[model samples]
Structure formats: C-alpha cells, structure tokens
Target: MNEEQLFKQISLVRQATLKQLESVTEAQADEQPEGFRNTIRWNIGHIYVVQNSLLAKFGGKPVATPSRYIELFAPGTKPADWEGDIPSLDELKQELEEQPLKLKEVLSGQLDDEAAQPFLSLPTVGEILNFTIYHEGVHTGTVKALKDKAAK
Candidate 1:
C-alpha cells in the first residue's frame, strides 16, 4: 500500500497495543504468562526496535541501535549477557507515537518505492509493514495474557 496507509496501519496496531498496556504495572510487564509469554514491556520495545531498524535500513539516518540493545535484539545477535536498564514502557509508547509521524514525513511519496525492494525474508517494505500488522497482534495477545497472569 501507500505510505499514508502504512502509517495508518502502524498507528492502529500501536494504539491498540498501547491500549492493552494501559494501567499495566511494571510488575505485570515483567511477569511471564503461560502460552503467552514475555514481559509486555519487552515485547513493546522489541517491536519498536524492529521498526526503527526497518526504517533505518530504508533511509540510514538513525545509525545503529545503542550498543546494549544491539546485542540483545539485533538480527542473529541474541543477548549473551546483557545487564542494563532499558527504556520504560511509557518511553517506548511515546516513541511509538512520535517516531511514526517523523517517518511518515520523511517517507512521504516513498513508502511504496522503499517497501517495494527486497529486504530480510520478505521482499519490499510493504511486505514488512504487512507482517508488522500481524506481528503486533500476536504480541498484543501475549501481552494481554501476561497481564492476566500478573493479576493472579
């Protein structure tokens, strides 16, 4: 689809995910739930980092991930021994809200073109955006489940 549409989809997914996270405590985000695992906070940051990398590759403006998260989240670069503070859930959600508008501005009239190229397992940015839609949904479910577990 077009850039506007892509932005809309991203915004929708992020908003819904943020809604699920509303009123969530730090404890809930750190808890692991059955079937739906992973701290909500981690997954949220994970998705944000993915998007940042995707966009950075598309335009190469953001440089690389900070040394810390790079090892933890980079492709084929799982954390060996990471031990540091990560961005809080609120910070991540704020970035989710702010970064897209900047990306949309830079990507105006370029979404289809940029996303049309081959990248990763998917060919084209469009494919990645589509994948992101479902990716967020799956994680959203997991986060919701985690919240359920934390409530117990």
Candidate 2:
C-alpha cells in the first residue's frame, strides 16, 4: 500500500482507539487489572510516544513529546514506578487524535523515502510506518483487554 492509505489506516485505528477510551475516567485509566503489567493510561501514552518517536526517528523531525513523556512512556518505563505528574487522559487523547495529521503533514511525499537506518530489517519510512500500524493494533487490543478487566 501507499502513503495515503497508510495515513488513512492510521487515522482509522487512532479513532477507534479514542472510541475505546471515550468513557474511561482518570481512575479507570490508572487501573492495572489482574494479569496486566501496565495501566490503560500507560498504554495510551505509549501509543503516542511510539508513533511520535518513529516519525522523528525515521522522518528526521524533532520530537514534540511533552516534557518527561519519553521518560514516562518510553520502552521499559512503567506506571508502577512513576513518581511525578502525568498527562491527563484528555491531554493524551488530544495528542493521539492529532498525531496522524501531524505525521501526514510532516511526511507528505516522503513515505517511500528510505530511513536513515533500518529498523529490525525494515527499511524506508513506509516500512516502519506499516510496522507501526500493526504495533498500534496490538496495543489497542491490549487496551481493550485492560478496559474489560478494569470494568470487572
């Protein structure tokens, strides 16, 4: 598939993720149900962080992450260990909602362009972006499962 299609898929997945998070409260977002290592909030923040980080890494744009977002949400960071203020679910939703558009804007006409470095055998911006689609879907599924457990 091409860049436009990838962007559309990204938007669709993001919208679905937002819908899943629609009625979740801050308390609910913070909940880590049995068998889960991270909370819903952590998953959401992770989605935001990973996407922006990929674009910045492959697209060569500056990361626009909020202060400490990387520290809080990057790989291996966990909510159980956090000791500071975190972005509200509303803030996370806003960033997640806007990111696809921002990516489209920054990456227009550049999707097929090669990345500076290959990511796990994936070359090209589009390749990494396609991997991100799968990545987000996995996290989205995790969020759904977490939401279900949290509701119980």
The candidate that wins on lDDT is: 2
Candidate models: Cα lDDT each:
0.65, 0.85
lDDT of 2 by residue, 12-112 (tens): 98999999998899899998877898988999899989888886776565547765899899889999899878899999999898888988887888888
Clashing pairs in 1: 115-125
lDDT of 1 by residue, 1-152 (tens): 66667789878887888898888877666665655435676677676677667656743334245555554555443223336776676777787677667656665665445443355667555566567678768878877777777778
User: Which window of ten consecutive residues has the lowest lDDT sum in model 1?
Assistant: 73-82
> What local lDDT does model 2 show for residue 92?
92
Candidate 1: which stretches are off by over 4 Å?
34-37, 58-67, 74-81, 114-117
Alpha-carbon TM-score of each model against the true structure: 0.76, 0.94
CA lDDT of 26 in candidate 2? 89
Number of the top candidate by TM-score? Answer: 2
Model 2 earns a TM-score of: 0.94
Task: Report the Cα lDDT for residue 18, model 1.
Answer: 85
lDDT of 1 at 5: 72
